[model samples]
Target chain A: MPTTITVTVNGTTRTNEVDERLLLVQYLREVQNLTGTHIGCDTSNCGACTVHLNGKAVKSCTVFAVQADGGTVKTVEGLASNGVMHPMQAAFKEKHGLQCGFCTPGMIMTSIELLERNPNPSEAEIRRGIRGNLCRCTGYHNIVEAVKFAAAGTGGKK
Target chain B: MVTMTSAPFEYMRPKTVAEASRLLSKYGGGAKLLAGGHSLVPLMKLRLASPQALIDLSGVGELKGINSSASGLSIGAMTTYHELESSVEVQRAAPLLADAASQVADAQVRNFGTIGGAVSHSDPSADLPAVVLALDAVMKTATQRAGRDIPVERFFKDFLTTALRQNEVLTRIEVPKLPANTGTSYIKQSNKASHYAVVGVAAVITLGADGVCERARVAITGAGPYAVRAKRTERMLVGKKLAPNVIRNAAKRAGAEISGSFNEDVHASAGYREAMTQVFAERAITAAVANAR
Candidate 1:
């Protein structure tokens, strides 16, 4: 049976009727027209579908939309306020953290989560923190630098 | 990527443990419980598990949280790996569990995956099975009428299978606190891609007043059909000091102590797994002895 769920996405409340088996990633991209969260792997190997569920990073592809009802979800689109980008997003752009930009959104989302947990993380900690999210662009060198830069509090105007 | 999604199934979100048990009884084998959905959802996407119904236990309040006492600790099955990894009680009571939980998959998976789901799934390569087995933990389950406790030894029957009946739901895990003068460790060689153990060893050793081993428990995973206790190796350590030579000789017996044939998969061959099991077993026991009070 189709269920009507209310999920607060990017600080905005959304009520929609979704299929019982619809994945949260599919719902965010297709139903809500929020295409920022990319689906890289159907299996949970690639972390391109990373998003925050009640403040913790989780794979959206593996979570059903109905299961997230009454939950607060934070996607890549929710990071920026007004027109200013989040520090993690700004760091990615400043450090050239993208090649094809396919995994950039998920990478940025996951990095912000890492920074939140550990305000200042070591290089090895950054690598382990974002291990779940894979960037096919092979730009991990720059991505790691971006996270460190954001952690330093100089990556963006704070 | 293949457009793999779970098959259509009825979803039931039960608010209470009793309700969840009742729903499982109503659906029987057709129902699969969803804890974190980290393991099951992937199988469903690959069409390996096509349940006619899914009983969502995410909303069950009674199945979430941790309670500790002098005897042991009772952890709600729905508690996430992140919670377990960061828990001070878990770190102090059973560091083997916290250490193993931290190694499960990655940050995202640890944040969502629950210890209960991992135990119930009974994946041989999973880190928790061996850790829980070594800890002598007890598995608690609920049904429509009664609740029962099963030891870790009998709880795991085969690969990807448990003693949980169709009508039962695993509610919590009771892990006895490691005794004084005891130390434990869980070490594994994880596959880079999936982070599943190639060969994992969990050991707990309680040292006697004279520094000789009083009790020893060792369990291994990834090299067999299911995680098995290294009884031969454990017996060798029971009354002896953890000398380097004695530990090495005992570790060698772990490869032969397993009951079934070694698991040979794309990541590792049977012979390689056997060799690594011996190496990891030694490493785990040495570490445990070093930390023993």
Candidate 2:
């Protein structure tokens, strides 16, 4: 049976009819037309579907849309304000944090959440923070550097 | 891409432990208890398990939090790994728990995955089962009618199986407090991508005066049907001094202790897991010895 759920996304309230099995990633991409939350690995191994669920970063692919009902969600697209990208996003671009940007959105979103909880993480902590997210292109050197860059700028916040 | 999603099941989000237990008892093998769904959801997506109903435990408030008393630490079944990993009380009382919890799937998974669910699921490759076994923890379970506590040694029945009855729900895990001068370590060889341990070993040892081992409890994961205590290794280490040769001998004994077949999945082979188990046993015991000082 389809369930009626109301969720707040990107600062906008949305009420939609969704199947019980519909994943949050699908709801974001198909229903809301928010493609910024990419689904890299449906098995939850790839962190490409990372998004903020009530201010904590989680793989949207692992969460059912109904499970997210009444919760606040923040996708990669929601991080920007008025036209400015989040500091983590800007840091990724400035530090060459992408070769094939498929994993960049999830990486940036996850890093944003990590820094929120821990503003100044050591190099080892940064690596441990993103251990769930996989990036095959850049070998994570630039991603680590990007997080560091953002941490130095605004102490890893917006 | 393969379709990775749970099969059609009657999902009921019961608001109380009594309600969930009633559903579990009525559904028999057709119902599964869903705590964080970290273990069950993945298997459901893979079609390995197709229960007719899922009793969601997330809404049950009684199964959450870490409660401590003079007897020991009692962690609710719904207490997420994130809670255990970051809890100041856990870090202070059972620091090894925080270490083990920190290495589970990842931040996102840990945020939802619960300690009771992990131990109850009985994944041999998981990090917590061995740690709990080494700590001599007790698992508490309840049905609508009754409740009971099972020791960790008897809690894990076999691979992907636990002593929890079909109608019973795991409610809490009790880990006893170690005496002063006790040290513990958890060493795991994780699959870099999945974060599941390829081979994990946890050791808790107490040192007497002159650095002789007074008590040793060693448990190993990812090398057998279930995480098991290295009885031979533990027996050999007691009353022995913390020396390189003694630790190496005990570690070797731990490697030889496993006689059953191992998981032959793509992550590892039987031989490779055995070898890594020995390596981790050595590392964990050595680290525990150092920490004892």
Candidate 3:
């Protein structure tokens, strides 16, 4: 029997019927239609399905929707407020942090959390922080620059 | 969407260790303990493990903490890799352990996976087993029948198998404090894509007066069916001077002592893994010796 789980996504609370085995990525993309969180690999190898579960970044593909019941989830789509890009998103755009953009959402999400923890991270720390997220298009030179750019900006709004 | 393809099993979330043990005792082999489910979930997705019941230990409060004591350090079974990596206690007592924990699968896997789950799962490629063996830690297991402590060497029995019997739950891991002037290092060659260790070597060495080796403990992972101690290399180094020549020779023996073939998955070949094992052993020993000094 499927369980009804109530979750707060992108500042909206919604109740949905989720199978015990349904992954959180599918729930976000299919049911909630928040396709910003991409699923690059069904296995946990790819960080394309990254999201903030209770303010912590996690690969949604590895987590069951039911496991996130009653938790607050922030998807890539939630980063923008009033149609304005978040600082990390704007930094990526300004610095050309992405090329293919398939891995951009996850990369941005993970970087946002990383910056939150350590605002003035060094180049090596930034690389280590985003080591889990893989980018195929851009060689990550711009991404590192984007994180530094975002870190220097005072206003959260980009 | 990846859904559970196996037969439906009874799921019980136990709030306490006693409740979990009771469920395990009742279900016995039919029950499987669910920690973070990072290791077991993937197996179940492929229909590898189909237990009739699952006892979820996520709610267990007793099995979660990283604290130090007069004896040594005690890490709760439910401590996640993220917790270990950021723990001040772990960083102070055994920095190598924190380093190994940081190298686990990835950020996501480390956040969800528990240290106890990794140790109990006994995956040959998992990093903590090698660290545990090198630290000479003790595993505490509890059951409805009784509770006992098993040395890390004997805790792992075979491939994907542990010394834990049916209804037994691994409760805590007790890591002994290193003697004075001791240093440890862990080095591994990880597959870039999966981030699983292809071959990992961890060494703990204590330097005696006059720069002689007082004691040596070495362990290797991802090289065979289970993590094995480099007993021969350890014996050769003890009582010897801590010099590059001795370290190189002992490291060579350590690599040579690792017998049997490693699992040749999509990651790497048996030959490449064997070669990497030797290289990693040398580097790990050299680094550990420097730290000991």
Model number with the top DockQ? 1
CAPRI-style docking class of model 2 based on DockQ: acceptable
Q: Please provide, for model 2 over B169-288, each residue's C-alpha lDDT reduced to its tens digit, 9 standing for 90 to 100.
A: 888999899877889999999887888888999999999978899999999998888889999999889998979988988888786667657666888888888878778999999998
TM-score of 1: 0.97
Q: Predictions ranked by DockQ, top down?
A: 1, 2, 3
For model 1, which pairs clash? none
Superposition TM-score, candidate 3 onto the true structure: 0.94
Encode model 1's per-residue lDDT on B37-129: one tens digit a residue.
999998988789999888889899989998989988899999999999999999888888888999999999999999999999999899999
Give DockQ per model, in order.
0.68, 0.49, 0.42
Alpha-carbon RMSD of each model? 1.9, 2.0, 2.3
Candidate 2 residue lDDT tens string, A1-158? 67788999989999999877677888999899999889887888889999998887888887777777788999999988989988888999899988888998899988987888789899999999998898968569999999999999985444
Query: lDDT tens string, model 1, A1-158?
Result: 78899999999998999888889999898888899999898688889999999888889998988889999999999989999999889989999988899888888888887877778789999999999989887899999999988999743323
State, as a TM-score between 0 and 1, how close model 2 is to the true structure.
0.95
Off by over 4 Å in 3: A154-158, B1-10
Which candidate has the highest TM-score of all?
Answer: 1
State TM-scores per candidate: 0.97, 0.95, 0.94
